[model samples]
Target: MGQRMKPFIILFLNLLLCQSILAPPPPVDYGDSELSLKDVEQLLELYDYEDGLTIDEPQVEIGTLSPIRHKAAIPEPEHTNIFSAEHELPPQKPLPRLPLPPDALGPQTQRGLPTCLLCTCLITTVYCDDLKLEYVPPLPKNTTHFYGRYNKIKRINKNDFANLNKLKKIDVTASQIAEVDEDAFRELPHLEELVIRENQLRQLPELPSTMTLIDASDNKLGRTAIKNEAFKDMDNLQYLYLADNKLDHIPVPLPHSLRALHLQNNNIQEMHEDTFCNSKDMSYIRKGLEDIRLDGNPINLSKTPNAYMCLLRLPTGRLI
Candidate 1:
C-alpha cells in the first residue's frame, strides 16, 4: 500500500511542475508592453480560429467615387438680338446760275488803234469787235486808256497792259469774259478807274491799289461777302459801284477814302452795326459820302434799322 501511495504522489508532483512551466508568467504589467515573436504568433493563431467573420465586397453605386459635377449645363446661343439695325443720312444743296459775256470776233487789236472799223480813233483808247479772239494783247507803251466794249474776249491774258504804265482807265463792257487772271492789270500801276458793267460776272476780280473808281454794276454776284482787306490797300479808291449784284450784307470796314458807294437792286437784307465804323474818317475829306442805294432790298428796312437810321443822319442823306 505504501509503495502505491508513493507512486501517486510522484505523478502528482510531476503534473504540477509542468503546469507551472506552461502558464504565461503572471502578465508583466509594463504599462505598454512589447510582445515577443512567440506571443505575436500565438495572438495571430487565436484570432484565426476565433470567428465566422467574412470581409464584405466594397459597396459601389453608379455615381459614387466620381469627381463632383460642378460645371453648369450649356444651353444654345440666342440669334434674335443680332438682327436689329438702323438707317443713314442725306446730301447737300447746289449753287445758283450765272452767265458769261460773248467771245472776241476778230484778230488781236493793235494797242493804240481802233480795234474795229466801227470804233473811233482816240489818242489813249483801244477798241475791238465781237469775235472769238483768244486774248487781248497789251496796250501800246503810249496808251493811257482802253475801250474794247461789245467784244468776245474770254480772258484778259498776260502782258495785256504790259507797258501802259500811265494807263488810268479801262472800258471792257459787254464782253464774253468769264474770268480775269490776276496778272491782267499787272503793269498798269497808275490805273485810276475801271468800267466792266453789263457783263455776266459771277465774282469781282482782284483790283490794284492805284484804282480810284470801279464800275462793276449789272453783274451776277451771288450773295458773296466782300472781304474788308479787298479794298483796304486801295488808298485812292473813292467810288465803288456794286449795283444789281447779289449782296446780302454790307461789307464791314469799308475803304477810308471812299466818297460814294452804290448798292442798288442787291439781295442785301442786313447791315453789320460796325459796317461804317471806319467810315468816320471819310466824311472829313469828301464832306460825307454821296449815296448808299438800298432801294431794291425789301428786307433791309427791318433787318438794318440802325443802318437806315445812321444813313438818315448823314450830311448828304440816304437812299432806300
Candidate 2:
C-alpha cells in the first residue's frame, strides 16, 4: 500500500510545480510615469517646430477659446425731482408788454432793465425808495445813482452791484439790514457816496478809498467796530454819519478832511484833548469838522472844553 500511494503523491506534487512554473509573472507597479529632463527638452523642441510651421500647414490641430463679449452701455435717465411738481415754484413768467415812453419805446425797454411804474424818463437814477421792497432790484448797466430806502432788506450780498461799473452812489437807508458783506461795495471803482442808515448794522463794512461820504446810523457800532486809524487813509472823505449806535468813545483824531460827523446818540462819554483840536496848540482849529453832532451821549461838553476849543460849536450832551 505504501509503494502504490507514493507514486500518486509524487505525481500530484509534480503537476503543482509545473503549473506554478508555467503561469505568467505578476504585473509590476509602474506609478505615474514622469518624463526625464532630456525627454522634457525634446518635447519643448517638438513644440517649437510645430509653432514655426507655415500658415497652410496643420502644426498641431487644436481647439481655441471663444472671444470675450462686452456688455452694452446704459443711457442716462430723464430729469426727475424728489419734490412733486405741484409743490415746486412755477417758472417765473416774462413781464407783460409795457407802455411807450418818450424815449425809443421798445429799444429802451429792451435794455433788459427793471421797470418801475413810478420811474420817469431818467433811467440812470432808479428810485425804488419807500416802496416797501424786501430785496434790492436789479439796476441798469449805465445807472449812476441807485436808491432803495425804507425796505426790508436784511443783508447786503457781494453780488448786489457786481458789474455795475458806472454806478457812483448807492443809498439803502432804513432797510432793517443786519448783515453786510465785507466786499459788498469794495469792488466798485467809482463808488463815492454810500448811505446805509437806520438799519441793524453792527460792524461797518470796509470803506472804499474812493469813498467821499458814508452814512451809517440808527444801528449798533461799538468800540472795536472802527479799526484803529480806520478813517485815516480816506484823504477825500468829507461827511461821516455814525449816530444812534453803540460807540463807547468818539473816533478821536478824526480825519482832517472830515466835514460832518453825526455821532449824536452814541455811548461816547469823553473826548481827548486832541480829539478835535491839536493838544500842543489849542488855537489850531478843526474847520473841516465843523458839522459835528455829539448829542445823546453821556460825556459833558463843559468838562472837555479844550477838546472842543478848536471846533466852531460844542457837542450836544449832558454836562455835569
Candidate 3:
C-alpha cells in the first residue's frame, strides 16, 4: 500500500548490498594471520596435546655406547673358618755338621796347605823359619814351640818326632841335620828345649829325659857323639851347650843340675878328678857347678888342676 511495500523493502536492502560486496576480500591479515589467546596459549603451550598415544624413545647411535649390567658377586667358602688357626708350619730341623777346627785338623804344608797356612802358627808356636825347608813341616798336634831354623833338614825320621805329645821347644837350628832317629828324641814326654845347633851332627840321638836345655853345639860331636849315660838321665839338665863340638872329653856325670857348662871349642884334652868334684866326697862341695867354659879346648888348665875342685869358677882354658 505505500508502493506495495516499497519495492519489497527495496529488494531486501538490495540483498544486503550484494552480500557485502562479493565476499572474497577478507584474508590478508598482515598481522600475520591472527592467533592471540596468548598465541593460542603459546601454541597450545608448544604442543603436548595429550589425547593419549605416545610410544617413541629408541634412537641411540651417536656411534655406540650401551653396555651397563653389573650385580652378581657372592662366592667365598673353601673351608670358611675365617681365622681359627690352620697351623702347619713346624717341620724344619736338619742342620748340625760343623766340628772341624783345631786349626782345621792340624798338620800340613809341603803345599798341602794348613800348617796354619805355611808356618807361623802362633797359638802353640811353630815357626818353620827360613822356609827353604826340605822337611819337617808336618807339625801341628798342638805343637808347643818348634822352630825349624834355616831348614834343609836332612834326617831326623822317627816319624820326625812321631806324635809330638806337646813337644816343648825343639829348635832344629841351622839344619842340614845329619841323621837323628834314635827314635828321634825318644818319645818326647814333653821335651824341654833341645836346640840341635848348627847341624851336620854326627850322633847325639837317644835323648828325652824331658831334657831341660841341651844345645848340641856346632856339630860333628865326635867321641862317639855321646850316648853312654848322656848326661845320665838329664835330671832336668840345665843348659849344656857343647860349644863348637867334636868333643874329646868332659861329658862327665854332669847333671847335678849343672848351671852353665858350655865346653868351648871342643876336642877337650882331659879332665877327670871326678870331673866336677865329689872326688870321693872331700866333703862334697859341687854347689850347682858354676859356669866352666874351658876356652878353645886343647885343654891345659894347668893340666886339670884338680879338675876345678867343685867349680865355682876357674876353668876357662890355658892356665899354663
Best by lDDT: 3
lDDT of candidate 2 at residue 141, scale 0 to 100? 68
Where model 3 places Cα greater than 4 Å from the true spot, the runs are 1-99, 105-113, 116-141, 145-167, 175-191, 199-211, 219-235, 245-255, 259-281, 285-298, 308-320
Q: Candidates 2 and 3: which is better by lDDT?
A: 3
* lDDT by residue for model 3 (225-309), tens: 8866677777888888889988898877877887888888988887778778766766677777677787998878786567576
lDDT, candidate 1, 116-222, per-residue tens: 33354356565544544455644446567777777777677656776678888888888877677666774578888998888777767677888899898888777
- The digit string of per-residue lDDT tens for model 2 on 52-77 reads 43223323447998776876787889
Model 3 lDDT, residue 299, Cα: 71
Ten residues in a row with the worst lDDT in model 1?
A: 50-59
In model 3, pairs of residues that clash are none
Best-to-worst TM-score order: 2, 1, 3
Ranking of all predicted structures according to lDDT, beginning with the best and ending with the worst: 3, 2, 1
Question: What lDDT does the true structure give each of the candidates?
Answer: 0.62, 0.73, 0.74
Cand. 2 Cα-lDDT? 0.73
